[model samples]
Target: MKSVLAHPISQEMDSVAFEDVIVTFTWEERPLQGPSWRNPHKDVIQQILRNLSYIENQWRDQHIENQYKKILSDI
Candidate 1:
């Protein structure tokens, strides 16, 4: 629902809605290489949408951990 990006070097973060994230996704099956457990052409966007909640949670956890470490280092 908020900024889903988490990077140590980025000082400014961009905010985006969950719906916006879903709406703005664009991809191509072509020009893709390597192997996978499933077909790469089958609804890649939908699969990512399904897993977005888990991905968001991981980002939130990582962001919190980073903030905590920053505070500890500042002390």
Candidate 2:
């Protein structure tokens, strides 16, 4: 008997000017006690990166709008 598990981690950064952002993705490998166990860490990491990119874009758009609103309000 064996167990299979994979852990994926991701991070996103927003630019100070609210014009750009970056995303980082990584994974952690655990002990695999089964012969049939396959490491899907890479695929998981790729998917996480894709999702993070999408989220980052959305965040940048919202941030820009918010900044514009703030500037208008201040004026």
Candidate 3:
């Protein structure tokens, strides 16, 4: 599994990979926090996004290993 996060302003892609899968997450700065669902604080949103990316990376790593092991066991 491969995961990537793209920064629009910097136009760069931060990526991580595991086995044969890939995933991506991206973020953009928003003003006024328009809706209730939107975070009122930009810092809080940034932290949450970072945590989510980390979790996804860990999950993919474990998942890919499990899949590969299973495939080999079937042989």
Candidate 4:
């Protein structure tokens, strides 16, 4: 995960192979909104990574919470 989080993410990722099939990803970004989201090089990598981590944590917590709720419901 560190390797994934280490680099900037705004650039196009193209595609990759899983095992039997291939998968692709394409992203076309608009303009960055806030001053903090801006990069002089016209890159939003850092902000993208930050947002990705935030969403990852949020979804992870939500998944765990749902699992707990399910277990509680079984009780």
Selected candidate, larger lDDT, 1 vs 3 = 3
Q: For model 4, how does the per-residue alpha-carbon lDDT over 12-70 read when each residue is reduced to its tens digit? A: 77675555463333443434345664454246557767899999999999999999999
Indicate the TM-score of model 2: 0.44
- Per-residue lDDT of 1-75 in model 1, one digit per residue for the tens? 677557566778788877875533235643363356235635786787779988999999999999999999999
Each model's Cα RMSD: 14.3, 12.7, 14.1, 16.2
Q: Model 2 misses residue 62 by how many Å? A: 1.0
Q: How displaced is residue 21 in candidate 4, in Å?
A: 25
Q: In model 3, where is the ten-residue run with the lowest total lDDT?
A: 23-32
Between the candidate structures 3 and 4, which one is better when assessed by TM-score?
A: 4
Q: After the best TM-score superposition of candidate 1, give how far the Cα of residue 30 lies from its true spot, in angstroms.
A: 26
Kindly give the stretch of ten consecutive residues in candidate 4 with the minimal lDDT sum. Answer: 23-32
Q: How would you encode candidate 2's per-residue C-alpha lDDT over 1-75 as one tens digit per residue? A: 896558544466544842444343344343433334434655766998999999999999999999999999999
Q: Tell me the TM-score of each prediction against the true structure.
A: 0.37, 0.44, 0.44, 0.45
Highest lDDT: give the candidate number.
Answer: 3
Model 3 global lDDT (CA atoms, 0 to 1): 0.73
Candidate 1: count of backbone clashes, pairs at least 3 residues apart or interchain = 0
Once superposed on the true structure, which residue ranges of model 1 sit more than 4 Å away at CA? 1-47
Model 3 spans with C-alpha error above 4 angstroms: 1-40
Query: CA lDDT of each candidate?
Result: 0.72, 0.70, 0.73, 0.70
